[model samples]
Target: MSAPFVLLHPFAPFPLARRTRWLWLGVAALALLLIAAAGQWSARREASFQADSIHRAIEVHALALRGAAAKYSYLPFTVAQHPDVLAALAHPFDPAVLQRANHYIEEVNRRAGSDALYLIAPQGTTLVASNWNTPRSYVGQSYANRPYFSDALAGRNGQFYGVGQTTGEPGLFLSAPVRQGAEVVGVVTVKVSLQPIQEAWGFVRDPILLTDAHGIVFLGSVLPWLYQSRRAVAGSDLDWVLSHQQYGAHHSFALLPWKMDPAPDLPGFRVQTTIDGKPRQFLAVDEALPELGWTLTVMADYASVTRARERTWMLGLLCAGLLLLGGLYWQLRERRFAEQRDARRELEVRVRERTAELDEAHAFRKAMEDSLVVGMRARDLDGHIIYVNPALCAMTGYRADELLGRLPPYPYWHPDDVEQHWHNNDATMSGQAALSGFESRVRHRDGHDVLTMVYTARLIDAQGQHSGWMSTVVDITEQKRSALRQRQHEEQLQHAQRLASLGEMASTLAHELNQPLAALSNFASAAKAFAEQGRQELLVSSLDETAAQAQRAAEIVRRIRGFVRQRTAGQEDCVVGALVANVLALLQGEMRQQQARAVVRVPADLPKVRGDRVLLEQVLLNLVLNSLQAMQATPLERRVVEIDATVADGRLHIQVADHGPGIPAALAEQVFAPFFTTKPDGLGLGLNICRTIVESHRGRFTFADRVGGGTVFTLELEVSG
Candidate 1:
């Protein structure tokens, strides 16, 4: 036989307590059922209490309606007994009797506060009315077939509600007969306004209604409900209601909205519906007005009453649930507190150990920081200095006391850097700046500018909030001065190297000047010989040649003078082809003397390069002359120098290629080094200066061996559009 299976659930109070969950659930179900039964009992009791209240209210309002009607109900009978009313009927055509009766009824209607009081002649014609003086007078109208009129003619007092044939207003028509000894001579009717009673119902805060026998609501507190049928009328009832004009001729005759459930066995007279968009349960009750053949209804809302009981029951249930939960929570909370206390004790021990390690680490860090040469400073979000290490004070020439809690621009900041300092402060505080390195100047202790390179990052506290920015700064003032001095020394050396190149070109320049001078001298001799022969044409030709040679010599002098002129850093757009042509012209005589073939190849439309025109010209000249000197070891027939300019790599590339032995691979890296040269009398600063000049223009100067047994030096300069 199989052993009984037992379940053990982790959430159970005990290992065997899983089955108790269902028992608890069963109890909850029973409790809900009891609560529901209690709610139903409470609802029934409330409904009964509400029904009785509605009934009492209906009876109370019924009396108010009667009192409103009684205000003018006796006026018609009293008018019937008047002599003027009888006299008006006796001599119906006499204006005097009509006037007197109309005035008398007007006084009665005014006192009764009724709509109108009028007399009907025996011929069914309205002879006079209280409103005879007004335009809507009923003096000539007929109500011959009216029940009230017929009943009065038959010698009985009658009451009917109908729309006036003359005036369109609806009211209660009370009629009484005038007697000529036992004969029914005429009828007197009174139209007592129902508006006052309707207004009274409005003050009671309950829905009240007065409906006719046909279930048509003739008077009601709500204007929309007035003259509406309480139920759907059909057949003769609808026709009679219409034909009799029980309601006004303009009434819709539609059924009012009852929205009732037809289910049997529903208790109480409560109706739950929205009235004018307000959801409410109204206790509806109707009472009979026996004399008027009308029903009076009164409605009272019981929503507040029901809600109060529901609120009380719900509050009790809530308090009970809370008390139970509080007990359970107290039990579980103590266990949790024990576990938490153990955890906290363990955490406290671990924290103590970790804190000791952290303290040791912090001590080590403090020692390291004290020994550091770089300065450490921190600023809060508002740009106020919060911390400054000893190194920072030394770097800024300020004491810790002076710098702490100070705001920028700090006194130690260089005067020229104050604006930049403020800008950096704002950018840092606003989180618009990145963590990177920047160079700034601060005042030194000796009253001089100290340059510092700072690396910074935003400071975050233990809570991971942006507390401020921490910056590490290194004083680079001496380094910067040394670099400046080195640059000046290099500039002087470059100048001296350029002068040496000029010095080397002295022999070539002298030979170039000798040709033009010799030509001018020969032309002068020719002019003198022609002058002796009296040949004017020959002498003029000689003089023209002499002038041409003189002009040629002057042009060479001007070009060389301008090329050798020294200038500070300056740049302009130089057309590559034109610049190449100018260099060639300056070295024209030298190339011819060297017996070297110089070829210039450049795109006619090559774009311009931006650099100092003289510097670039010097660079080109130096490369070409170096190529010529290199070719001295080769045969004169193999010597060739090529100057080529082209656009390449979004830059202006000008190459000087020579068919000379290329540089050895091992020494190629050192080709651009200052004072490095293979020539016995050459200063190696030429290539270095060329590279520096190109770099200063944001370009490059490099050399490589050509595939065709030659060395090519290339200058790549930025192209300016």
Candidate 2:
């Protein structure tokens, strides 16, 4: 006996009720059996419907393939059934007559994309050919032995499917005899490609197995893995089908049991229609093409059919059980009287005990609710707020009474966050999206902002129906403030570093400016010399070269101004290599002053990045200057500074390393800090600014002490591509 049954006592008032309850149990059992029968019947009905649908889909595929094959047959007949070749072959062909035959072959070749077209003479000699052999090799070649030529020559019109002699592809060969006074004179041969027919059968999802009339599979597109394992229609299951009488008919169905040995078994199958020779099964649908003696097939797993049937059965069972219980409870009043009396008395006792339990549960729920640190709110399926916990009220600075049932577009949500919050929250309420946590911001009642992290899940009601969503939110305001301040400090540091770079390069700037001015003077002198000698070409080339040099000078001055000058803060897309080349050109004189040579190793295909060209150049200039300074103490051979630009982790990386002594290990981290320095008369802002510039471009800057003596500084900037 069950524990609930044992707990019930058959005392004076309950003895009669106990007897009556047993009578009702019997009635319930009868009702349950009827429900189960009805459920299975309904399941069988739905299974028939799905099977019918599969059958229709199979028929549609067969019609489509037949139509495609018919087109292939029609094209060859149109080309082969022409009369112009009949008249020409009636008489011995002169060279002119043979040339005319070639024109007919060309016309047929164009009408059909055939690989072979030819005309056979009455004497069994090939007269003209197109796409047959190079230079019409078969023109004078004998066709006395070939089936296509001889069969037509004997006054028969027919077609043959064979492989090509040279191309070795499946081809449909059609031949029709040209008649003269009811006697055959010549045969027209047309060979067409069969690739389109294979393509038409490719629409099926599963493997296709096409067998000839002799039960030999001639064409197949089986799955690679299954092909490797060699499990196919010719295997055991198919052999069993062939042995069974049910499979021997034009249309009959059977379910056979089989095991999948090496592979774990999926849901077992409930097979549908089966047949042998006939093409009721999709795998053999086009097993016999009247023109080509070929077949088309598509094979699907029987397990899928069974699983679909099972799901329909389960749905039917649930619906039947609900209907049966509702009908029996309403109709069987007299039979349940004694049982009802006992149940009422027991219910009275349970109600009193349950009332006390409910009171205790309510108190526990309140305690749990108070302990929550995140803001909590619940909304019904209709999108009406049902409750708001104290934490939520405290977060939004509103009382619980003010928030409950106040529909969304709640004043506590920021305008920008409102749409996203409702969209994400509604997904949980509608039971469409999984319970994924999201982050958003809400406006406080006091007009301040509150960044929040929210987690939510759906709540189901007593009837096992989806009811609402309950969301928990936590404040992230402090984290947001910290990030904001950090970004501001980085921007200030970057600005100070840019100013310091211009100050340090002031002397180098003067030397760089003098270059174009000197070039202009030389070009002007050359023009004067050419004019005096009456050399017109020299004057023209000299003036052109001077203008080019002047433009170069102007560009250098503009880059210097752009570097030192402050402009509006905005990021522009620039290629890393192009921008680096401009910087190297600007710093060419400064590099020469230190007797240091620079090697720019930026790849030509480097990705473009969004950044301020001036600030990026400043960072590059600082690293190059540092390299030049470090090499000032080294021998001439070690003075080369290598600047390389590459992409890593979806970002651009600029690495500057010199061959001179590397930085001391102790100062690596300190080098980027404001006012930190290792050199005499240094403000130590270059490395710090480099870090700031990189960060502003959404990047990072780092320095590593070289294995030798010099320092290597790297700047990283993001590349959207």
Candidate 3:
């Protein structure tokens, strides 16, 4: 057996136990002190980190707010320099001048995204406003008591924020004085909405507040805090706010129930407030917007710092407890080490097997890529070709070695399309490639062009990080050729249809030219008779009539020729009135024969539209002729076709309305279908062709029932600038 089992003690058991207990107590006390120190350190660290984060966020927010305001800063000054504004201020009672100024203000306000743009007279009367057309317009209103008006009248740039008296909307008002020589004539004020900035702040979890010089909150992420003062308002400040109507008449100007104190170990202040009937703490950071005389404050949750401190204390206690258990675990460490060695050996074997399987998978993927018919290529973010499969090499007739490591303007790009290829490459690199893929022409090694459709997607590495772009290219040469052939065939058919339409209009054309020619003959005969009788005055008058009739006949012939002439399609600025006149002239004989009257109501001031003149004429002619034909059954006195044109929202609208029976709703969908017709002898291509022409000109063709009893066909086209 081993040596005799004997126990030895350094001291008596009870005294030793007491000594050990005291030692543990002392150690525990020391541990408690250390834990407290660590908790304090953690609290400070967390507070500092939060303070820095809040400081950065507040800077961003302040910059954003400044940027929003700055973008509209020059607007007021720019408007002040406008001639219309000056004219309106000088002639405030002149409706024409005021109308022009109001329109200009409206356009500028819309384009600049300002809430209200208005001009104020020297006496503080609103002369013109962007909302002049609205019932709640600021025009004719007086703002003489407003400080911004006063400052501008004093010949200084003025800036103020307040609730609009007319709209009750809060906005920042920027004003500039309109001066003629040394005299201050008027003020140009621009009101910019701060709601967007407040909305952006609301996206964050922190409470953000924007306060004016009087410590009143003008804008805040928390809606209830807006217009609330940080301190009590009294004396002159309260009087000024009330007199100026700064926060509107109804605001009570109550103080926010919040208090601030210097944080113990942080760079910012500790703020305590009652929100929703519960107390909350925050670390508050302030940034001043000196230019606007405002302060931006961001408040972050302080409870997180407290939680971090408590967690630090708990973690320290856990470490001390772990140390106490360390001695108890020492005996089993060697056995655990032996067992871990065996486990590690088994894990190594499994890892080796997994490595082999991964290698096989990679090889299989490579083989699959190489066997694909569609070309595959991969590029890094910098646009250097990193990989190309064998199919890509065959498609471009270039070897992989020649394609790899290549930048844009690659050898496979068509020589004439290098710039286009570079543009596509840039778009792909910028992650703007279209999902439907793009078509490109690539050059083969043999100098032949190959049409290709390329689709690009972002390539991700194993860690799910974007590495580059992967492109799949398909050879669409044959497909494109087929489509081209089909388009050519369709164009031929359309040309034939146009010639057929002209053929059908031949009778109407002859009728239109007959009356003018007949009048010319009559005048010529009269002139001859007058000359033969030696009557000089009668001869001159007859000759003048003859010349006028001849000119009319020639015009009819010219219009007919222009209508039927075949030329390449082109676009130009065409006047709407002129288009309507020509269409009616072409169909004059038809209207007269059918006993139908034409009522044209085109605005003289309508802007020109950009389109092919002949094509537009054809569209109008077809519609008018159809109208004339449709109203054949109506009573002679009531049969009328109305052509109306107007300009709205930068677009030209032309409507052709008739007083005949309206088209049935069931047939509306089929009206524009090719080869679909309501007439027995009609080819059913007029409406279809008209729609095609309108759409090709980037205009819309639509029809709806008129208020009374007929169909109204509308053509909406963009106005030429």
Candidate 4:
């Protein structure tokens, strides 16, 4: 029998009290289960209601969008059949017919409130436009590439939503064939801006988005949701959207840079993200707008669902608490009748338990002594071992039989310490000095000396007479050697740090001197020309300017020292073109030295990036210099480094490509580690620091081999607005 049951079995309690307790518990559990089931049912009902409401709201917005689209739907077709439009299409270049058609279309556009009304020739040229007086007018712009133009020329009415090529504004473009008798002559086109429809959605006070067939969200109630993609798009498909500038200069279709995870076993997803530094959760639903070939996604506030669930649980808990109180009152009444007898039997059980506890404790002490990490030994006053634990035997690599009952000069005592061990034991037995702490070396069975810590205590019997001495030993060899090695390592580490600091200081000074020294040379040469021309005033101004520039060069040194502790450089928004031009100016000397040619490719309207200008200049300068040095073995004529910059997916990607021997694949991963270098004289921090600066700005940098045979380093920086 189990000890607990055997002990309590002799003195039993009233059986009805146990039954009463179980009955109350069963009732409480049943009520709790029922409450939980009801709450779950209510939650399901609310979720279904929410889904239906979203479907209805999406349907309402779809109708509203169709209504707005219908307002100007027939305007394109009506204008195509006008007598003057047909006549102008037939005459081709007749000024009178063109003037009449333009005036007629302009009047109709003004009355219809359309953004633009234009007449396209059969050759796809715009002959007239309603906004001819505006700066972004499309009077003579070519529309041959537009899908709407081709569809209309093929004798079918077509509708499209895209960014205008001439105006760069997003609008719905509609076109219809202008028929001359039984043949298509030209096209009548009308463009209606989508700004009004999008603005109208803002009044709905909920997140409602409309995406085209391509899943591009061109119209939306949420400001951040506009012009975003509903799903991930591959590079090829994204390139098509970018090539046409479908939605102005925007990159990427992702509504959020992160993917949203859908809730398990639920119809809607739960998105948890930070808003204004505080976390928020949103539940969203998607529906299709079949009439317009668009998909509508509506996001609703889910706080209400949570609130309802909380209320249900709160009510259920209150009811359960009331039922528990009633059960406790009955339990108090039933406690009075519990059996009250058998004092002698309880006393007998207690005595047996006490005896068993003592026996268990003695066994526990024996096991602990045998398994201890520190060695324990006891010896008699006559210097003969009386007792020794397994731990002591293991410490000296011997069996208990070999150590127990051994004499003062034990086999485990080191030869060099044998006299010291006996002298300490004699003192302890005589009480000349009260068994103090000491250290000594011991010989292990493996025949090696190990440093051990020793402490002695008196082993007295029940009569309080000294019977023996107890000694505990521990191995300290590893600890002593570790401390020595640590001291040596710290000294070496300090020296290495000192060397690194000096190297950085020298490198910074050299780079800072290069720029100003070059400028000073140019100024001095110009000064010579001024003096030769006998222009005293110009020469005096040049001398003064040169002096100021020389002082500026010294400031660079002071700034670098001051910036040692400041890891993040000062940041400002910078234009890509201007940044490239400045860095190329700094690299002219390096290019000349290496006999390398530099070619820069950047778009004028490329997105601006945010970073510290000085730090960025340093990063670019290092890359260019590396490229120049890497091609030192190449023929002078073939030493070309191409600097290319493009904006895509909200990132400004800059590629520095060189035609030279590429890095070996084996060493690529190690090149970025501090102190790892390829060149004999390389500090290896050039690429490391470049990557550090880029990462500080939340950007990335990577390296690859160019297709023709060289290396290409790509730097990706986030675009600023």
Q: Pick the candidate with the highest lDDT.
A: 3
Off by over 4 Å in 1: 1-12, 15-363, 513-569, 633-639, 648-651, 659-676, 688-710, 716-718
Q: How high is the CA lDDT of each candidate model? A: 0.80, 0.67, 0.88, 0.77
Report the Cα lDDT for candidate 2: 0.67
Our tally of clashes for model 4 stands at: 1
RMSD of 1: 38.6
Could you tell which candidate, 3 or 4, scores higher by TM-score? 3
- What TM-score would you give candidate 4 relative to the actual structure? 0.43
Off by over 4 Å in 4: 1-13, 255-278, 329-721
**What C-alpha lDDT, on a 0 to 100 scale, does residue 253 get in candidate 2?**
23
Poorest 10 consecutive residues by lDDT, candidate 3: 1-10
Per-residue CA lDDT of model 2 for 1-721, tens digit only, reads 5876666653555877787778777766776676566655554554455445545655665576455445445543454456555545754457666667678777667766666777777777777777543643557766555556667888765554444443446555667676667777677777666565456555655445544433444344532211111223445545443443112231212212212232112211232343333222221122345555545444454444345556655766676667667767775866688779868988899999999999999999988997788788888887778988888898999888888887777778787777787886567666665456777888889988888988877777899887888788888889889999997776666666666666667787777767777888998999999999999999999899899888987887787767766553467888888777877887777777878887888888787888877778778888887888778789987898888888777678889999777876676667778888877778887877777678767788887776667777888888853
Which digits, one per residue and each the tens of the lDDT, describe model 3 over residues 1-721?
Answer: 3333333343447786688688878988999999999998998888998999998898788889888788898998899988999999888899999999999999999998888999999888899999999989999999998888999999999999889888888999999999999999999999989887887887888799999989999899888888888898889998888899988865568988789899975666998997777799999987889999899999989999899999999999999999767744764675488768868989899999999999999999999999999999999999999999998898899999998899877999998998899899989999999999999999999988999999999999999999999999999999989999986775565566567666766777788778878988898899899999999999999889888888988988887777776663578999999999988887777777787889999888889999898889988988888888788888888799999999878788999999889999889889999999988878888898889888988889999998978889999998884
Question: Which regions of candidate 2 deviate over 4 angstroms?
Answer: 1-361, 364-373, 394-398, 408-422, 439-451, 461-465, 513-554, 564-576, 601-619, 644-655, 664-676, 681-721
RMSD (Cα, Å) for all candidates, in order, is: 38.6, 15.7, 10.2, 24.0
Steric clash pairs (candidate 1):
none
Q: Candidate 1 vs candidate 3: which has greater lDDT?
A: 3
